[model samples]
Target: MAEREREPAGWQLEQSAPEAYERYLVPPMFAPWAERLIDATDFERDDRVLDVGCGTGIVARRITDRPGGVGTVVGLDINEKMLEVAETAAAKSQLEIEWRRGDVTDLPFSDGAFDVVLCQQALQFVTDPSAAFREMRRVLGPGGRVAASVWRPLEYNSGYVELAEALERHVGDDAETMMRSPFPEWTGEDLGTLVRDAGFSESLRTIEIGSMRYPSVEEFVRREAASSPLSEPLGNIEPDVREALIEEVRNALEDYIDDEGIVFPMESHLLTAQR
Candidate 1:
């Protein structure tokens, strides 16, 4: 395997994973997707909104920034570190958002507490998606709606597939599993059934296609590693092993690289349901 001379500077900073996620992944990936998910639903001015699993509070912040503003936006995530980042970001933006550390399966809110519940790229990680859906429905008011987005499958997200395969080869199976966990193998029908079983009445599912770009393949691997559970594992590996992993990803994703950087198509299932 080919190796680079040195690992990129600051690659071993595992303590800043959440901050890295907000700074790196949110702009290129989550923030744009959050706009799409928010566009799919109708949010009236002053409508109470809850963003479930709101990493760094991008969706919550966006909703509050919307033209007429919203009513009582709350951002909830199980990871306190992520919530800390979310709080900091919201504070920086001078946006008033409640950051709550709570589990998705059992939300900490009263019944009919929100008019709109928005979840972006989080349902797949839930141990019990059905329970999470139930909680979403339980907290929504009469005629309220829930909007959530989940990556379609690994096959549809080519960039991540290559990255996961490279991690399996160089890092370990656990690393590959961690990388691929975001893109579940659930179909649109499967997601609809999940919401329906959770007592949501009217449901709509759509496929949203988008692109993710990185300055280079190395940056791609480095930023993704820095932002996720793979941070410590990748940082702990031998420097040469890390270089080889990046080389593998570069070779695999060559077709997607251009003058700008590495760019690849991604797909997700956007589901909206009413309670």
Candidate 2:
């Protein structure tokens, strides 16, 4: 007997994971939060900073290279392939960020090993966020801070909303099935509750990062498509549907575009709590 094939229930597409995440995803989608994270965090030169689920070491490098040099910047991620890309980028940029392969929910760091813990856009994929938060809290020193940033509701982020609209038109209402992509969704209040539940005795505040615009609709699409998990499913879509979807996205951005190109706003919420 032959083995059974897995059935597609959700966003079952094999998505594209490209090196350009550092280039594209960083600018519009990620830059806002990265900057907010930097602002919210207070790191001394000798402080040890741990970046959880550090994708391509973007946040790690940012904290390490702040105004003063950090004592140690370590990035931990479950995906070695992502770490490989991160290491390559670090090496190319001449940054000495330590990239480690590990699970965020069960961090391997010693107790009170870090002065600051940062988790950016990583909580969504976590199977257990409370456990992940506890792990992050466990690694923080006394008076240390734990800061995390995650996507607001899809309705809050115009870029993602536009993408979803485009997908819905092409794949019909079923396109939302693609919404189950790797990107996790956690509200601002949810982030605060998680931090408090993890034993952080602190107040939580939601800070609006900012918005970004792409040069053109195609530019936005390429950036989104190249990095989107939905890209694979979109590619598998009949060419007619794919083209139609692209057109729908283009149409959605008409009100937001200028001579510079298509402009869309992306928003994120930052949650900070003390240990």
Candidate 3:
């Protein structure tokens, strides 16, 4: 018997990865965390601010919207597609944000150029986070502050654990690896040490606990895949395999599901310091 071939309707993302990321992931996960990261710093109205790895300009946009507004808000990212989306969004809102495409490890700016450096959920993806931290410190003036956030680990994010295991079982090791890459295995003390080694002073690491909610387990899987590199692979997989993967996650997260949808607690290490 031949298995029928059918594409899951939810798997169809009729937009670019960055666009989907802005539509799906930013609102739920990144935007709220952006607020927390901003709160960790002494962001003044007239201070020059730089948002490292500013995906879709959430943090940059938020800074401009703060009371009395901000001065010279710049958002830097390595992905051109993300920068394009960010530029368009800022222009639409008439925001004077400068979107620059550059690497965090080597910022294309002069020394002591910014007053505050804010990175939200991006330190983990850097190939050399310590170098990136040093660059952040270099761009900050004396008494400037740097605030960044990184997911604690997979163990602390149980929903992702179930999803990663299901991906390995049904998709492949590569898919599982892609899903788990965001959650770094670094402790709070390790984050403090990294920034201190990079010449940051008075480093403070705090564990911020938050929750993410999806309309359902299926939407959770669908949105996560659509917004990330997994979109192509998940969209290309056999429909039955995709179904099994979602089902496994659904069963595993049944306890977390409620009348609204699937809700799970997420944890991250917020590191703040002065340069």
Candidate 4:
């Protein structure tokens, strides 16, 4: 798994977790949102951009690969392994992305350094998501735009709901809550409130729910289980317990497999605003 639990003791990804995550989790869990988040904004080629909380650089690569002059792009993530993976991808693609290992709460750049800031599905993992938004606003240039997305509450997230249910049954409530607690406890209106609290004016707030199709059921369970915060619980127990948990999740996920593949409804909330 590419996820490493963040240190000083918080729910973050482990260093070894990135490779597994990029291969298994990114395709179905995040790839669609990368396209969707970028589509939410009308970014100019020459506009300087920064992707906060970029995991494995999916959004960064897209920004750099955008036709025309998508301008300088920087990716910041607290996970070093994730940054290493991002840098490796940048080298392989020959895209000039400035990837840095840093926290979303405290950006390392000077104030007003970027014209556009994007965070794709990274807000919920932060200790203080609102503070992270404030940092995005802080480093943003005058009239800059910020686009970020968060999974709507756990209840609305089909994939996570199924996974979490299995986890609670196996790992008990403490670990289950620890991992799922990062999900925003409110709605799109609550998301808007956070944006406004960060001194940004919201232009759009929408919940995008769509079906995600994985190539196979095994890959879906492998990737989804590996990347989930629940992975820690599965990892701590004996191999048999972990396998049992995986099997339970796999059987539950079977409801999603179809003629095309493992298709299931997934949802995320997008927030686009200006600072």
lDDT of 3 by residue, 212-261 (tens): 98877888998889999988878778778878998999999999988777
What local distance difference test score does each model get? 0.91, 0.74, 0.91, 0.78
Q: Candidate 1, residues 64-102: lDDT per residue as tens digits?
A: 888888778999999999999999999988999988999
The order of the candidates by lDDT, greatest first, is 1, 3, 4, 2
Model 2 Cα lDDT, one tens digit per residue, 100-166:
9999899998999999999898888888999999999999999898888876667666766877777
Q: What TM-score would each prediction reach against the true structure?
A: 0.95, 0.87, 0.96, 0.86
Clash number by candidate, in order: 0, 2, 0, 14
Compared with the true structure, model 3 gives a TM-score of 0.96
Query: For candidate 4, what is the lDDT?
Result: 0.78
Residue 102 in candidate 2, Cα distance off native in Å: 1.5
User: TM-score of model 4 relative to the true fold?
Assistant: 0.86
RMSD of 4: 6.1
User: Model 2 RMSD to the real structure?
Assistant: 8.2
lDDT of 4 by residue, 31-143 (tens): 77898999898798689999988989999998889777587999999988789988998899899999888998999999999999999878888878788988999999988
Ranking by TM-score: 3, 1, 2, 4
Model 4 residue 194 CA deviation (Å) reads 1.3
